[model samples]
Target: MSIKKLQIPTYLSALSVMIFIIVLTFFLIVGKSLLIPLFLGGFFAILFTPFSNWMESKKVPKILSSVISLLCMALIVGGLLSFIVGNVASFTSDFDDVTSKINTYAQRIDEWTQSTFKMDYEIRNKANPDYLKRVLKENSSNISDFAMKTVGSLSGLVLIPVFMFFFLLYRHHLTQMMIMIYRDRDPNLVKMRITSLRKVILHYIVGVGKVMIILAILNISAYSALGIKHAIFFGVLGALLNIIPYVGPFFGVLLPVIYSFLTKDSLFYPVAVIVCYQIIQMIEGNFLTPKIVGGNVNLNAFITFLGLLIGGTIWGVAGMILVIPAMAILREIFDLSNTTKPFAYLMGEEKEKTQKNEKPEADNESSE
Candidate 1:
């Protein structure tokens, strides 16, 4: 008996795959509104499942239990938003002081410009005194369009909780449906696959949450020690933004640094803010993430950065938030197939020498 190779001819297969990808991308873009909400709903549903299950085990009705679990999630999100808004409102209440600081900074900049460039700052200002006003007047329609888009985005936020509630209510049915779809595979293997996927998604989300909380505490302590006002607000906001990975830490630090400079008499305070955040971020990147998140997602730096860029391009902030989990899901799918396992290996982190040698070394020791 002869074994048959499973290879398809290159060009025809490649063309078919390319066409499929194009159609998939088209639908993704066109159906983003419907899809984005569903994805977010699925995400929160997974997070809230344990609470709902516990309530059920205690003989609570499913609908009521789901409502209670959802309320818990809402309160947590609402508390964070309220904290941020309160701090911002307090800062804004001192508007006059902020304007005075801005004026002082502008005057210093003008003076430096005059001395360094041998130009009269007043003459340059006179040349463009109405330039900003003229530009704003011309772009009034664009401003209106942006405002409209923002309002639309906010309204979409309402649908998320509704979707999440339903997802939680029907989670058991959904799990069974997924298993049914894989009925062609071995029953035990399909069950194992579903279980593994659930565990990976839940573990990744929980681990990331733990890391964020730890960072928030560290950030708050550092800011308080530096005498920054509204330390908790800045720290929490920064920690939340840090979820975006590489670009996020820089932006997280930038907000506090700017606030310190604008609100303080000395430039040194802003510098201190930057230095403090950098140290915390360094520790977070090297220690906290590895220990907490471990190798759950196992994606490499290049792939991660590339995912961020593509995600940002496609769906803005929502894409960036959802992309890592999407990658994890894709990696798991790829690993399940012998033909696609190589792709999964590529998505994973580069192999460390010690890890690569461990199996061989163990075998050698055993033989000895």
Candidate 2:
């Protein structure tokens, strides 16, 4: 007599997976303050690995190389922030003018409506020119509260570079530890998969960088042609926000439209801005990203959108930013195991073979 293999019920397997996910989510939410920076650091480490290695090859100590890498990153980020802050300072300085213009516009629209349609354009008593100003004034406390919270989170911000530094310094040790942890599996397969994941992530990042540069050029040209105020500011910012996916592009469009409305003499400018941006958006989404970024990611649109929502819900903006890379990693990791291949398929953009490409079942039966 021979023993047969034991089978786990499908329901039991699914339930176990669900329980694991629930537990993992709970932990992520609980430890997010620490985890967020650590995750960000790990990503930066991955992105900087090649640069770090180049420094090491020149006989620089690992610690010093890591520090140098972090400094480079800081300078890049510092410059971008400086650009935005300097422009934003000037933009915000004219808030009184923005409010005044909006109020005047509201009053004019109200007059037109009352004369033409015989009703007040009754959104927050638009008849009152000061209503818009009052609304902003009333929300000042809430704005200050948000600013305070952002300032409070600088502690976590401070930890990001620290984590990146250590990650780079001990990158080899970390690889070894991972391989040792998977002692039962062939270490070669583990190493191969890890390398593949890094390449994919790196290529995706480089592609994204290219997309940003192209978008920045296009946005600045369009805004400049339209004579939009702070053309460089909006263009650079819009390009930057595209990194966030779904909601990002919307806000990217919204910002210019708001400014155009506030500062321009006519409604035509805002509509023109929207039209120009949409054409550019179509080109970026349909062509640029698909050709450049999508290949490395290999995630279908549905899964990507779902990931963005779940990430946003879990960790707010940071979660949204990190989730795509996390999904890319998980999808690739799933591909490593036969048991997890279905999940990989679910998360990926790969297609199945057509009926015409497959051998018929009747042919197999005849051969058997």
Candidate 3:
């Protein structure tokens, strides 16, 4: 074949890939208003599928099953919100006391720094106290602004359960539609790929849900044992943030550290609180996650981390939570095609298995 022929095909392939990426990015950016609720609805629908199925097995009608599942979800969410609100109200009411304790803690830290560093106390005071106070004040305002904006944005999230209900009600038809769309070109391949994608997403959702619940319980227990104020609030916050992947573990640590700094008169308490978070994360990552999630979703550590970073950049925290499952679905689709199988393997855990046996068979066939 002529050089031009080979070059044209390669160039066209590259262009197609680039265009697909650009289109996807644009959709993610512009479709947020519609996409956010739809995505959340889909996610919750999937999570609640088993419950709906169980209700059906017990002779409940499909509509009733969906309604019951949705109501259960609503009750859980309302309970959690009430707990968080109550704790926040109590904490705010005691704000003056908390501020006084924080100031005393700061003084102790300053004294310790002076003694440990053997620095001139007057110079250190001039450099540190003003800057720290200003930063803290700005951070507090920013946090308040962020919370208000989040609440404003989430006011529409009530639509999620509504969407979820219909999704569950007609899930069988939806799956059938999906299969029909892909069946014309390659039915077997399409079905396999879809099945793989579903397994990956379902396993991840169920696994993470269990992990978050356990971590929440452990954190609440630990905080209670340590006599931390607002134990339930911090524990629940940690669990929710943990859904955001890598950065979430750090966020989980930050809540308790801030509480310790604001409520106790010693840096030791904050350090201990941070240490506790680290320990919990270590347990979750090494033990709980591996056992629960297994190796079902095949994205490697680097790609997984990159997916989170890019997803967060594109769609904020919700993106961070959704990206891994989305990527897994994409990987499943790619793995179905001979042309794109390599890309799927690149994002997968089965790289060695994919390489060693398949290539040799292909080489031998070519030689024959």
The estimated TM-scores of all candidates read: 0.85, 0.87, 0.81
Candidate 3 residues 324-349, lDDT tens each?
88888888888778989998988988
Each candidate's number of clashing pairs is 0, 0, 0
Error of 3 at 322 (Å): 1.2
**Considering summed lDDT, which 10 consecutive residues are worst modelled in model 3?**
143-152
Error of 2 at 223 (Å): 1.1
Q: Which structure among the candidates has the greatest TM-score?
A: 2
Regions of candidate 1 where Cα sits further than 4 Å from its true position? 1-8, 110-155, 352-354, 358-368
Pick the lDDT winner: 2
- Report clash pairs, candidate 2: none
Give candidate 2's root-mean-square deviation (CA, Å).
4.3
Candidate 2: lDDT of 129?
Answer: 40
lDDT of 1 by residue, 24-95 (tens): 878877777777777877888888888898999999999999999889988987787667655655564433
Comparing candidate 1 with candidate 2, which one achieves the higher lDDT?
2
Q: What is the C-alpha lDDT of each candidate?
A: 0.80, 0.82, 0.77
